[model samples]
Target chain A: MRIPLKIGDAFVYGFAVVLVIISFAGMYLMGAKSDRRHVVIEMDKREIYSIEIHEGMEPVELRVDAGDGRYNEVVVMNGEVRIEEANCPDQLCVKSGAIRSSGQTIVCLPHKLVVRITGAGGEPSDVDDIAH
Target chain B: MKRYIAKACPMALAICLLFLPILQGCAINEVREHSKNLFALNTWINIRIYAGREGPKIIDSAVRRIEEIERRMSVTIKDSDVSRINDNAGIQPVKVHEDTFKVIEKALEYAKLSKGAFDITVYPIVQLWGITTEHPRVPTDEEIREKLKFVDYQKVILNEDEGTVYLQEKGMGIDLGAIAKGYAADEVVRVLREEGVQHALINMGGNVIVVGNKPNGQPWRIGIQDPRSDGVQQHIAVVEAVNESVVSSGDYERYIKDVYQKTGVRYHHIFDPATGYPANQGLMATTVVAENSADADALSTIVFVMGAEKGLGLVEQIGNAEALAVTVDKKIYTTKGFDRRLTVTNEEYEIVP
Candidate 1:
């Protein structure tokens, strides 16, 4: 048996292939950026320290003083940031647990301290505080 | 010929598919341009401005406006207007900028309303506690009691005509720490409006003042910082704010805890002028929403100091003002206006009617 080929059928097949190509191209162009974990610490509304998160890194402990006797202690281990302790009347930061994803922040208000994790191929998943 | 036309039709469609993403991307560019900047203004001033070609220019003007307020109002700055007023306490009356005079007058009004629950003249006690510095200590009762003598807002005499502020006693000092951020937020709003920008958000630390609806015409959602939030994104509630300011004052933000002593007492910076200590009104925090950020800022502190019941009463009395108070028991009480506007996200606390 002989098979007949139609130009219209060929065109429709070409259009389907082009659509898939375009969609994939768009997806590739918008694919996530580099995933680098960065732990940022802000005190009194200023970025005081930042470190890159990596595997096998020795545990780093940070003690921050807001100059008013308020103290915050933070621990970074195994690419996760945690508030180990704080002299704040409310130890909310210590209860905040270990966070590894971007946009997760452990905030100790008494100490005017904010430790945030950012950089995971996209913006951190924090509240959108557009209202300044 | 008909077959050829059918083939050409599909060919055209294929070409269209190739350029579809490019076309959509260009259309999205027509959305309003948003630009944000963060810098020091009393606190970390975070501002997001939305406009067209004038967006950058509008943001710059807003920054300048914030800096001017910070220069005049910041008590931390030794040469600021409030500092000069503090410097001349009892010795002489210091003339300040009209903005400073007006804010002092407003602070006095808040003091009168809360009956000194919120006092600008609590600086003497604030210095003794030094909650935000490295030397924060629970002062001796005699020391706090002595400083409490000067913690009278009524002692602050504001001469509107002369733009002068006078502290009645030698030790009396005025610290605008409670309401300065709100004033700064309002001033930034004024500048943004003057620049013809319709939509903007200004966060002076956690004092958030929003101007106009979002660029898409939706109301801006302002997160109420959870008093017990271990993380930044943890919000007890979110309010749909439109042309309003949402400010929260709480003991959690700046405090020194001495739990090791087993007294379980925490020393926070928000001083109760009457006691010369952190306000112990059974409230952990208060969030206020009002037309102006300054009012919201001061009222939040006042409400936190006033506790839940009286705070709700005052909030009800004030027009265009609403409040959300989190009690020591973790119960949330909100004004009728706020109860309707807020959406609670945290299940640990219950929002009361």
Candidate 2:
């Protein structure tokens, strides 16, 4: 069976195919951009460390001292960063579980400690504020 | 022909759907404006100002204003108004900056409103607890009682005409850690408004204040931190706001380490002036939403200390203010008016009807 195709139909089909290709390309680029996983630990607005979250890696526990006995124990395990222990009374840091997504942050205000997950350089350049 | 039209219609729709990202990208430059810094108020402050190209400059001025306020009010600074008041406690009344006088006046007003639940003159007791200092320790009942003698807000005599603040007691100290951040948020709002900024969000260490709605005319989502969660980002409730502040106080914000971890007793910074211990009326956290940030900041502590039942009543009594209390049992109770504005995200805590 032969089907007749009009010029309008041909235009529509070509446009649809082009649109799908562009959208997929855009999504792939975005996915790649967000794939660079790194978690940064900062105290008093100063960077203490940044570590890559490699999949299938053994759990690593890091103890950070904000001087004068203020300490936060950061744990990297199962592809996420979390505070395992902290000396601050409330343990708000420890309660803030693992964060794997970019732009997610765990702030221990008493110690002025911040654990932030980012994509490439630091927290995504896009988000202006993490209003919690 | 009709069948062909039907197929083309969906194809056209899909193409339009695919074009969304491009449209969003084009709109971004015109719509999104933000500025953030850590230098102001000794806390990380992030300002999202949705304005024209002037957003960045407005944010800079806002930060500068906050810094100026910090210099005026900080007790740590030797020459600050608060430092002078603390230094000259009972020695003499010290003149201060106009801003400092206004803040102290407002703090005193809150002290009267909450019946001393949110007293600024609790600095001596705060020092004794040492929650934020190097020598943090749970004070004995006797030590706390002795320090409580200086925790009277009535002793802080402010003469507005002379622009002087005097502490009546010899050893009285004043710390504005609770209310100053809120005042900073309000000042930033004022600065943004003066600069023709319509939409903005200013967060000074989680004392979030928003001026107007988002650039898109939607309410800004301010998350209430889960008091029980280990992650600070784990918000149990999300409240939409326009021209309001959301401030929370809990046992978690500042505390000496939980020495008896298994006993579940924690030595937090929020002290009850009457008892001179961490205000333990069985509240995990309290969030206040109000037009004035200072009220929100102070009431969060007031309500937390008062517990859920009395706290909710107090919030209701105060017009233009609402509160959410998270109890030690993991139950969430909000002011009657707050239910309409808040969306609870955590299932573990039931919202008290």
Give every collision pair in model 2.
Answer: A94-B230, A95-B229, A95-B230, A95-B231, A96-B230, A96-B231, A97-B231
Model 1: per-residue lDDT, tens digit, B287-306?
88899988999888888888
Candidate 2 has an fnat equal to 0.27
Candidate 2 lDDT over B1-353, as tens digits, reads: 77777766766786787677677656644544554545456566766677766667777898889889999988778898899899999899999988899889988987887788888898998888788775787778888778888889999998878889999989999988888998888988999999988888878877889899877787888778777554356677788888999888887655665553656677887888778888998888889999989889888888987788887788898776999898888888889868788777788877887
lDDT of 1 at B195: 80
Highest DockQ against the true fold, candidate: 2
Candidate 2 residue B182 Cα shift, in angstroms, is: 0.4
Q: Name the lDDT value of residue B45 in candidate 1.
A: 58
True contacts kept of each: 0.13, 0.27
TM-score of chain B of each: 0.88, 0.89
